[model samples]
Target: MEDINLTIQKGEFAAIVGPSGCGKSTILRMIAGLETPDTGEVLAEQEIIQRPSPDRMMIFQEHALYPWLTVEENVGFGLELKSVSKSERKTRVESVLKKVGLDGFQSYYPSQLSGGMRQLGLAV
Candidate 1:
């Protein structure tokens, strides 16, 4: 992973593909602020990423949502951890649900959603 220089623009999508143990997950972890580089630095929005941030996230391949929690609950889990106001959490959850076409399925559990829906919930 030496001398790796990459920039992902806002609204742009990028993928890191390589054989196993090729540092793909390492790079993602650094960007997510879960890990730090030994020498260089990782920056997001022109600010050094010193720790995990609410604005940065990583969605793994497997379903990460809690099966017992409803769609809205799972989507708002992070906000809940941050101690966001319940009213604001609800509003933001609703907005994101609508954006991902899961607006009316807020009460549905993860098991009730299809694979694609579960994946979208992860992104939410």
Candidate 2:
């Protein structure tokens, strides 16, 4: 995590390569706004990131979606944070869930879903 400098252009794909314990996840976490740097600031779209925003999302290696909420609820959560109207959120969530092939499982909780299904939920 020492003096790492990088710039990823819009629509570009990037990779962080290193051996174990090299703080690669740390860098991604900072970029995802889940962690704050000790000194330098993190910016996206020319704006300094001071805290977590709904605009910034990352699918963690683990199933990070709420187990208490159903699939539809989980997908709609993002739109809800943006102040999207209830009906619009419902429609968008339903569309995304269906797009991810989770249509019939909208009422299912995380514990009821398989590993692949859980990952799909994050993508919603």
Per-prediction count of colliding residue pairs? 0, 0
Residue 56 in candidate 2, Cα distance off native in Å: 2.8
Q: Summarize candidate 1's per-residue lDDT along 13-45 as a digit string, tens digits.
A: 999999999899999999999999998999999
What TM-score goes with each of the models? 0.76, 0.68
Can you list the residue pairs that collide in candidate 1? none
lDDT of each: 0.93, 0.86
Model 2 lDDT per residue over 1-124, tens place: 7888889889998888999999998888888888999989888889987777866767778878988999988888878889999999888888887777999898999999999999989866
- Residue 82 shift from truth in candidate 1, angstroms: 5.8
Task: Give the TM-score comparing model 2 with the true structure, all chains together.
Answer: 0.68
Which predicted model would earn the best lDDT? 1
Supply candidate 1's per-residue lDDT for 62: 94
Which candidate leads the pack in TM-score?
A: 1
What candidate 2 gets wrong by more than 4 Å, as runs, is 65-70, 73-92, 95-101, 108-114
Q: What is the lDDT of residue 115 in candidate 1?
A: 95
